[model samples]
Target: MKRSLRRALWAGAVVAVTVAAVPVTTAFGAGTVTTTFTKAQDWGTGHETRVTVTNGSSATVTTWRIEFDLPSGTTISSAWDADVTSSGNHYVAVKKSWAGGLAPGASFSWGYNGSGAYKAPLNCTINGAACGGGTTPPTTTPPTTTPPTTTPPTTPPPTTPPPTTPPPNTGGKKVVGYFAEWGVYARNYHVKNIQTSGSAAKLTHILYAFGNTTGGRCSIGDSYADYEKAYTAADSVDGVADTWDQPLRGSFNQLRKLKQLNPHLKVIWSFGGWTWSGGFTQAAQNPAAFAESCYNLVEDPRWSDVFDGIDVDWEYPNACGLSCDTSGPNAFKNVISALRSKFGSNALVTAAITADGSNGGKIDATDYAGAIGNLNWLMPMTYDYFGAFNAQGPTAPHSPLTSYTGIPQQGFNSDAAIQKLKSKGVPASKLLLGIGFYGRGWTGVTQAAPGGSATGAAPGTYEAGIEDYKVLKNTCPATGTIAGTAYAKCGSNWWSYDTPSTINGKMTYANNQGLGGAFFWELSGDTSNGELIGAIKGGLG
Candidate 1:
């Protein structure tokens, strides 16, 4: 589990909604166009707002421009889905080139993050008509002629950019990304980033990682992160501050709001990852008891609506992972069978299995094919095949698509795993190729090639030997491609990981093989603008 380095579970950290505004409209020569502004979220310091355009006329509207005025203290910092530029407190927004024209009854939306508290825009107009379609409603006007009797603070709270969503489409393949529960702490990544970075728009489903499997039963990984930490209005998904009296707050509440924003997206609670897989041994002892506990927890009224299904990420079933499992090959199949019996047909039941495809390896240690009838999909962890785990020697790519000459291991690559599983009766469509969003590195390397020797693991921001693609994309870009993976020889530090180009190649292979879509270990690895995920979505198409 190359991504398992992130299993550093620590305590959780603590971390908001706005009013809906009415829309106005105007009629152009081609058709009638309408624009509406909504205050999506409001923290004391910053806020997020959205603008929606709709075509209400009989004919197709080719284009539109929106202009609006903000109060002296409010300003637009950043926006997405549309091109927006501002001068002083006045702003102009034009449709993006890719958005094209709107047909009859069509609606389009874009948004921005702003400075200061939430304040509705004024003098808003679409084309030449008042937004929403009628006369502008009257409102209290600021006294411009005379300065305010009581001057407010000269400096406003620091402004932050808000979420900007594009039109959602996945080209029919499932794009799943993991959102670590502990990320809110040191990583400072929240549910809102998923929407703002545009990953939310590209993703078909989100795996809320590692709900604890301690005691052979499902449990909360972090109380604060799971459903207790209060989010200020500014940090919230919908811009509504969390209340003490509310039934749920933390990421679960934020995920609820995220679902509202992106109705096409589904969230799954994933139990047991690398650090927690030991519990599966006990869980396998009585699969029925374990399945019942998971069902009760996933369906709890407190956040029953937050999840669409369950995903089991047992590191290795009936085999060795972080710790060894001697529960027998039938253990995995039995557990999945019980889960399907409990979760029923509507709920999605999925699993992430080992990628050790070497003959007589972990792939053969469990009855994976026997559990397929109960699973919606199976994710073969394709990365982590080779890394700095063996501190000294033979630098190799962590994720290789094919077996290359002088490869350190046979049947350790992605193609080998996929082929091995297929040979065992698993359907190509039921298997999802796993991509790692990070890279593994080693220091004290003599040669840049795969056969070089190394002294130790390279230093990283969070852990040794592992770093996010976001940092590696700049710090140590790819210098060579071998075994269908990218490697960088920056100084004595040699690192190997997948790039967008490499990911595109893998996606092409996925399509050619008539396999299911691709999934990554996590989300925060991508660029802030979602460059890597964009490549995955584009490649899948």
Candidate 2:
């Protein structure tokens, strides 16, 4: 996702409140606190809850605690953003160390997952004072009770099937590249560039991104650029011009020609992205329907031969991305399982997921390991861990392969995420290490090393704080290395990006770790001569 879009969504608050007899308020020393309980997501057997505490008084609140009671048979399974403890039916929540202080009018929220029926908490209290709210009314009992009876079954139960194991690595490494659909507009990067740059011969798969996930169904992102636009004979790969009306004439036809030139290449249509992932929540509601829509669109008779399979790019499922999702941990597994069932074992199925490896981070928010069996591979987005998003000093590398002494954040590096996923039961062979062909840096830096202070984001040709390696490599050549990555400080302007030398080191790490292979964000970032792509092919070999 773009940093600007992420900031816009984060600024917009998503709050839901339940009305009570009186507004919940509690008096403390020199201040007052009001807490609101909202249900984020609710299914039959499980649900998610969010509690927001606001400082309503003039004084700042340095610390806080909330206590409440749950209905009978309800139990908390997991929680985040706060420390929670339960005893019998009573639960107590304390603010996390990082979220301890709140200025007046500011609010902090924490969420949890629970089992059994959803119910608003009773006897809510903040600090030691009562929150002026009445308890929920008790359920009414039936006048008469009947004994339960059981009937014997005439047939025996069916046996359970054994779990399926993922296929072995077999020593074949993959080199996957993503081709953006909209790149043909302003970027003017045609499919022929792959052949011209020598990337066509090295690539094993080309993921055409991205098909849209709209209205809870798979849809074409850009019809004109995908298969409608006409190409001149000089621009066409096969040197054939399209008539005024042709069934397929756009990038689809060009990619088919490219595949013929490189017989080992496979093309997969990737659906959903950071901006389009909002529809995955609705898709999870009916996985079978979503799968059917995807199959039809990917295998459309118009250009069915263009795509070999499908790739789902639901960013940070059941967690925060461009939007927040409370679809529960198993939502990703259910969706992928449905796709596998619909597409069958022979068809390729894969996904691009979050690389957050911190405690209770995004990796812990979804069951990626459980869904690995249904996937051909999983791409952990190891880049974009940090960027101009912070917008201040403490400049750090956005895609470090390993950690350094003064790394800005913990568990944000690629190695941390890869190891975490492997520890969680995902086979190393099914996980592909992600590499970014771009660089993220800041300007106005005094120090050249990794923890330098910066004034703001560095300007780029298109967007600030980000630029393709093809542009950055010559503009600001790397001067030093840290934590197994490259950095450059050219006249007070600091930049951090992966160089050919650093890419070789990362590839060696992947091989030693028994990883399947490597994949980059997009092919357009490489130089016209395919310098970066050549390095990747050479290193992987």
TM-score of each: 0.70, 0.70
Q: Go through the candidates in order and give each one's C-alpha lDDT.
A: 0.75, 0.72
Query: Which pairs of residues clash in candidate 2, taking residues 3 or more apart in a chain or in different chains?
Result: none
Report the Cα lDDT for residue 365, model 2: 90
Q: Give one digit per residue, the lDDT tens place, for model 2 in 124-198.
A: 777866654443211221112110111001100001000121222113567788998887887788898888888
| Candidate 1 residue-wise lDDT, 1-541, digit = tens | 3354532110000112222222222212122455555554555566556566656676777788888888878887656546788888988988755455776666665666577886777767777665433233223222221111221112110111111121134444678899999889888889999999999988988999978888899888889999999999999988899999999999999999999999989899999998888888999999999999999999999999999889999978877778888999999989988887788655778898888778678888888876764666788888888778789958998888888887787777888888777556465556778898899899999798887999999999888999999999999999999877899999999999999999999988876654557889788888898888888888888
The superposed Cα distance between candidate 2 and the true structure at residue 46, in angstroms, equals: 34
Instruction: Compute the lDDT of residue 255 as modeled in candidate 2.
Output: 95
RMSD of each: 19.2, 19.5
Model 2 misplaced regions, further than 4 Å: 1-171
